[model samples]
Target: MTNSEQHTEHSEHHTEHKHIVEYGKYLFIWLGLLALTGITVSAAGINLGNWTIVLALVIASVKSLLVLSIFMHLKFEDKVFKIFVWVAMLTFAIFIFFTFLDYSFIR
Candidate 1:
C-alpha cells in the first residue's frame, strides 16, 4: 500500500477504536433500569401518603441518569459537555421548585 493509503487506514482505525463499548456494561444498565421499573410499578400499588411522588421521581431520576450517561455516551464526553448538562439540570430543578412553590401559595 502507498504511504497515503496506509495513513488513511490508520486514521480510520483510530476513530473506530474510540467508539467501541463493552456489551456487558449495556446489559448491566438494562438490568438496572428494569429493576427500577419494577420498583416503580410496585410502589404504585401501595399507599405512601405524600411521599409516593417523591419516591417515584427519585427512581425516575436515577433511571434517566443511567440512560444519559451510558446510552447517550455522555460519560465519555468532555468535561465541558458534562458541565453543560449539570447546568441544564440545575436550571430545570429550579424551575420545578418554583412551580411547586407557586402551587403551594395558591391553595
Candidate 2:
C-alpha cells in the first residue's frame, strides 16, 4: 500500500459519501421559484401601499433560502458553514433595516 494508492482510495471513499439531489426535486424547486415570482408580480399590482414592499421582500427571502439550501448545497454542508450563512443573512437584514430607518427619518 503506497502513499499515492492510499490517498486515491481515501478520496474515492470520501466522494462516495456526498449527497446527490435528484433531478425531480430540482424541477420542483424551480417550479416553486417561478410561482413565487408570479405571486410577487401580482402582489405588486395590488394597492397594498407600504405592505406590498414587505410582502415582496418576504417572498424574495423565501426564494433565496430555497436556492441557497438546494442549489448551493448549503444544506449538506457543515454546521459552521450554515452558521456563517445565517450570520451573513442577519447582517444584510440589519443593513436593510438601517436603510429603511434612514429613509423614514428623511421623509
Estimate TM-scores for all models.
0.77, 0.75
What is the number of backbone collisions in each predicted candidate, taken in the order shown? Answer: 0, 0
| Cα displacement (Å) at residue 86, model 2 | 1.1
> Which residues of candidate 1, in runs, are more than 4 Å off?
1-19
Give the C-alpha lDDT of model 2.
Answer: 0.84
Ten residues in sequence with the least summed lDDT for candidate 1: 1-10
Give candidate 2 misplaced runs (Cα > 4 Å): 1-17, 98-107
Which candidate achieves the best TM-score against the true structure? 1
Give Cα distance to truth, residue 9, candidate 1, Å.
Answer: 11
Q: Point out the worst 10-residue segment of candidate 2 by lDDT.
A: 1-10
Query: lDDT tens digits, residues 7-28, model 1?
Result: 3234533422254458999999
The whole-model lDDT of each prediction reads 0.83, 0.84
